[model samples]
Target chain A: MTGSSVLFDAPGPKARRNSLITSIVGGALIVAGVVWMAMTLAAPRESGGITLPGMFDESRWDIFADPELWGFIWNGVIGTLRAAAVAAVFALILGVVFSLLRSSRLKWVRYPTAVVIEFFRGMPVLLMMLFILLVFSTGSYWAVVSALAVYNGALIGEALRAGLAALPRGQREAGLSLGMRELQTKLLIEFPQAFRQMLPIIVAQLVVLLKDTSLGYIVGYPELLRATMNNLSSYYGNRYLFPLFVVTFLIYLTMNLLLSWLARSLARRRNSGGGGRGRRNAGGDADVSPDQAILVAEASAAARRSTST
Target chain B: MDVVIDNLPLYLQGFGVTLLLLAVGGVGALVIGVLIATMRIAPVASLRWFATVYTEIIRNTPLTLVFIFCAFVLPYLGADIPYLVSAFIALGVYTSPFVAEALRSGINGVPVGQAEAARSIGLGFGQSVSLVIFPQAFRMTIPPLINVFIALTKNTSVAGGFFVAELFATGRTLANANGSAVIPILLGVAFFYLLITVPLGLFAGRLEAKWAVAR
Candidate 1:
């Protein structure tokens, strides 16, 4: 059966009629819902509705006409990108370091590495950011950047460790036979393969890191969400809140969707390209959510555990 | 350490609110998520389109924006929901899509032959899905679903940002007051969160192993 029609057989004439009727009813309900929301927005403030300058009122959206507003938005975009970029770089470096230590042959090194990764993964990024800000007295930007780096670095480390574990044992054996030490084998042979295999997952995690930059808003960082919602909204007054929200929402949506699309396409390419043995275990599915990648990583980790024991 | 001990009551109160948010939001996400997953696989084209659009829009937007909508925009639109209730709605609506995706993947994991067999036995879509498919799909979904909830445990902290006195907000207040004890205050908050998340994670691993054997 086709994937779409797996849940049902081909519709008979009677079934076709039933489906059409349901479609029409569903369509009507959606339209009615939209209309109801519009009416509510247009209603008076005394009735516990929108205050004067209702949503549809042209003046409510007039703030977009100011070139200065665009400048503020541009600064917010730069702030978000700057934090995300710094975090992503530090996260990758930290991920590599953590993964390397985690895969160490020494129990002392490996166990502590595992503990640290789990601790970071288990903690909330916002909590970590707040802790850094208050305890260390780092500026808000460093708090956001450092927290995102440490948290995501832990996740990426696990994913990379999974990637390393999923590699064919022969690859490592080959390296050793060619006169490489354990560290050399991992650094020169295993790490690059795991990095390439887990690239899409890393990219997906970066999207998560980017979304979390909005948490910077909570800590008083002037990121896009804070800039638009707090700065622009206060400057323009409550009447313009909805318009500012719409613009901010669109900007976040566009950036995230683009990154997500990149992640999916990367997974697809890796799947089709027949890169290496790890490909079979490396989130072969084209639509890889960050959690799904982690799930795959967890499964591989589990597999590694079972084999070792 | 003394700071945390002295503020123990405050920590417990914040912990309680955090748990309350997680419980309410988890249930809300599950209910809305299952409905959306059902729509995504339904026979009707429009329903499928609507579910897909809803999931994408919600998934791409940051949790902060969702909180902003619940905290600020809803009131402006005449929906004067309470802040706690608004936090519940924000977490639910924001998280439901991830839940839906997890369920969808679980459904995909089910063997195609099973669906074909159910259809050959003359089961309707609802009968086949609810009776045969969902039961099996949910079994496969438990581990991922737990991961989702673990993520939700951390997400409850976002409510703190929006005026709910959850653990993170409590930590902030405590840290501000006891500036010298910021470390202990924040660590106390982190301990409470680990109390929820770490166990869920271990449970997920255990269940995944058990299910793998069953499969």
Candidate 2:
């Protein structure tokens, strides 16, 4: 579908005037809201008092320069990165294994694989993390990592399964026709192509993982969020809570945006590299069919379609 | 199972809060999402730009931050909001962009001919969109909307971090109280979440299958 609609006719003079009035009113309302918020924030109130100008106070940001506070933040960052890295790697492995099992020749494997994937996908990461931490006496680090792995692993697996399903039926058939075993056909032919297609989504899921790591704060994990909160409460009490939250928000936004940028670039690279295994929508090989490829293809296509948009 | 039964009252109260948050947040998201989606596809360039910027900013940030904003920023702005209200606002605002994206795609999925036909019959833009385009788009969006609701339900657990006494918070409190029975407590908690999510998932699957045929 096209990005923008072109079905409606151009506005006539009266319609243009109406549009102008609507735009002006809408703009005014938004500007008014912003002004109101600024006024409220800057208002000298006993409770919830945070003046707009206070955000720029040199003392408010001094924590950034303090070695003690900065050290804690650095530790938090390192801790977050460590967990994310471990989770991403293991989740990728889990994704690949689940996808493989889901696509296996054995009928028994697919049912259990699907059950596990769906269960994790539907389960909240916070619930899983807290459950693991409490049940196994695992610390926050392992709790965050394991929960992320299970949830995102299922998601990535689905993406890969879709990518595999998207391939022409002939891929597996060609491998078999060439005297290759099912395992060899899958490993050499389908897996590589599927991995390429799934790369962008995998990167996007990593960004999701990073965002979820913030949930580690609920368990008292010293991640970026929890660290920032601890520093805020101790250093300034609740005086600068909003400002610190704003700072934390910006950091998370920047990181997530960077990940999305990376994913987009990967998608662009895949699209522009021209006709190879990476080429999606390769026509003319429509004849070959695997037993359950249609379902897998639809599932993967749905997953990818949601992510790409 | 025995743990769940013993803590039945606590679990029930927590789940009630969970449903309250979800119900309120779900409706709020749907309304705001449709408005944003409308702005997104509207004829006004400024509206479209605003919608795009809002969606991008909201989608890129963590939901936890959104909760923090509501819990802290709203109070900073002089509103003494309760934790449940704060959680509801956060969930609603956070989920709206995703719902908008889904609805925007649904809008796009509608045939251009549908709009053209509405115009041909002298329907104004408002009537055409509200009557013709939206009806079909809403049908197309139901499954994704359900998915968003499911996500929002799971997300309400984050409210526990903000001290909202939801199911997760309830579980945490109970587990901490009965340290030796933490496993049973968590199992009960997970089961409660599943009680909400699993049926919704099955319903979504059913709707999806039915719609795939209708398509």
Candidate 3:
């Protein structure tokens, strides 16, 4: 839906005047906030500020000129991508497995799978990582990868389950009428359809998983945030902390924005490509994030459950 | 079992801190979120731009980096906040964008006819939104808002790494001290986290079912 336009009318003459006044005021406030932040950053350390030589001072930024520092950061970038790639693969595989199990006809299979999914989803990723490291004595990298995989797998499984539930009953019925067993229908027909419908959401979840790999810092994995904030800052001294943070922040923002744009574009294509299919999946819009999609899915699923019971 | 039994007080203390963070952070996020959501819909062009930019930046950034900024950069910039206070700010600011997105979608879910009706009655924009739209919007929002808080509950763990002695931090400390009981210690931590998240999930489900607005 086109946002906000539905909430109010097009501005009349008097309303236009007031809108202009508020716009000016808002612009001034934003400028004032930025200027104040700059002044604070330029203040002395004796006043509890960061500017020993000033935040904008050339000496503070001169560290970037060093090629060795760039090499260090490149390693960090690779490290973060490596862990995310491996974790994403495992998480997708585990997600498919969990979703299949969750859709099983047997109560025994479904019940325990539900409990396991809930358990993984409920626990904090960092706690799980630390637990894996301490209990199993896996290296820090494995701990981070495994925890992310399991947690995101549970979420992805739920998203897929939602997609499965949203599918038209005819798809499944037709498969069964063709003499296909439940498992075969789900695998060959239903699951592929669900996967296609949920592709945007799965990609959105991967973006989240990528952002979460920064938690590898706590587990002592050499991810981007740790490489910059922990390792680089220590190596370059505390004077460069703000500069390092700015660089790290930009890198992450760029990567995640690109991924989010990809998800939205995929949603847009899906919406435009298959007209009737798009309308059937509730909240499967270009703007919905993975979390929101899952929430919508769960809400509908809950409604379905209550009505059936 | 004995390890967990003996360290029950430590576990309780950590659980309390986690709950406190959740409550404080949840309130902070809701307040900021509502304000941002309002700005996004406001007639002022600059306000809408500001809100959109803020939401995008926060949504794309990791919670860990947000924590680092709150815990380190704020102090470096002369904001003498404590670790716990910083943790609260980090969680609130990091989660606010999601809250705003949910609220905006809720507002979108309100029927366009309602707004037209409000306008026909000579109601101004603010009056239409507050009196007519928001009340309806909030009904559609409760389930998703609850889901956001459930996420906030798990996010509190990131604060532990930033020096707040929350549940995950306590788990780390206890695990280091009693390495042999690592399994039980981590399990205890997981149990406490589940105590918060599971109930919230169930409550959200119930609310969704009960408040299934057929629009």
Candidate 4:
């Protein structure tokens, strides 16, 4: 157990240097690629917004630099951000409600909730949004919101339930000993704790929901992806790559990269503190017990030797 | 009752297309996913980095965006691949990273000993991987990959933009022709999706249970 040989240890100086060099080279390649794209298609490509390539002129970057195209791109960004905000709020409410149902005393509540969770979880959001759109035309906006709520909420609901299950039973007993009613015990004691515990997963999934906003395009929401497509298609003769490269740089890639970055930071925050001593580790891996068993075996062996006097 | 009676065939047609797209997209995603996942975890640093960039870009971008990019943008790039082919290519590529992640986790679930054992028995890396590793990883990947399948199935709805003859698009076209009957038509489509997804979901659950440990 105390062997000096390092197995899966931290990267040493040489490895660290290699990692740094690799990162630099990768970053350089991305910049070079972007620059090459810009140089080839950026300047002369003009007028009716960015476009995809067509038969006559295959380069599509020219149209993107047009000012009018910026308007559509801007509008799309607003729509996406606005939709994501509304969905996040609704998803939180539904997530909390379902999480409560999943942990209820009665099988009726838990089983029904479980069924809904699986059904919604089982379905795809694209299908759900499409279904809600076609089925309830007036509620098209709500349909998207509902899909976001149901899907993200279900996953979050599971995260909350997992967090609650991971809680020490003593905490629940402690709440009961304090004379709180069952609902009150859950709401006042367990809910807050579980919510905090599951915060990382919750954050990451919400970012996913945010990115899922691009799914709005198919329903003609004219979101970022749709707008970009329109702008690119309009310019589909000469400036093929520029429009895509620029719009992708500004619109889809930048915003999502930020959200993903935020998710990572949030997870890091929770991970540093950890879920708690010995519950599930933050990455959702469920198999630390075997390692603990090994530790237990070593401890017992040492104890037995010490007692042999 | 009247709606169900009348719409049964409609639902069935949509269900068939749903299953077709689901099957094609799911299998394609699984294959691409393994390739991407292998690249993602490759021994070479550059390949791993490239795969990382690919997965991050794909994962963060919306599935609908990928659909649109494939259908509309690809053609404009002088890559006149037809809509159906592009839809398949895009959906397949979009779902692959997820499958890769799922399978990667599944692979990790197999203890390091299995690989060590295979190596000891004179298996090279490829033989050990395909013969020893993939079978076990495929089992563990069932549940999460089911989630990916659901995603791809739903994506068939997006193929509407590309004019692919899938469920949602079919419903959209039919409903538009019928004017404001959009709601009912969509409801029919929902029922269709439910029939397909619910059963597959159940099947995945059973598979997961069979492979799952006591924990």
State how far residue B15 of model 3 sits from its true place (Å). Answer: 1.1
Position A294, candidate 3: lDDT: 42
Candidate 2 - CAPRI tier? acceptable
For model 1, what is the alpha-carbon lDDT of residue A253? Answer: 95
- State the TM-score of candidate 2 restricted to chain B: 0.89
lDDT of 2 by residue, A121-141 (tens): 767789899888877778888
Candidate 3 chain B, poorest ten consecutive residues by summed lDDT: B206-215
Error of 2 at A243 (Å): 2.0
| Candidate 1 lDDT tens digits, B1-215 | 99999999999999999999999998999999999988998777778888999988887788999999999999877687889999999988887887887777677766677788898899988988888877876766887788788888899999999999989999999999987888988999999999987898788768765664122
lDDT of 1 by residue, A1-309 (tens): 127477866789999999888888887887798899888776555644634756777888888999999999999999999999999999999999999999999999999998888788888999999988887889999999999999989888987986887576767888999999988999999998888778887887888889999999999999999899999899888888998999999999999999989988988887688645554554423333323444445433321111100
**lDDT of candidates 1 onward, in order:** 0.83, 0.76, 0.83, 0.65
The top-ranked prediction according to DockQ is 3
Docking class of 1: acceptable
- Candidate 2 residues lying further than 4 Å off, grouped into runs, are A12-21, A46-59, A62-68, A271-309, B110-136, B213-215
Error of 4 at A186 (Å): 2.3
True contacts kept of each: 0.41, 0.33, 0.45, 0.23
Rate residue B154 of model 1 by lDDT: 91
Can you give the lDDT of residue A134 in candidate 1? Answer: 84
Instruction: Compute the lDDT of residue B170 as modeled in candidate 2.
Output: 94
Q: Residue pairs in steric clash, candidate 2?
A: A162-A300
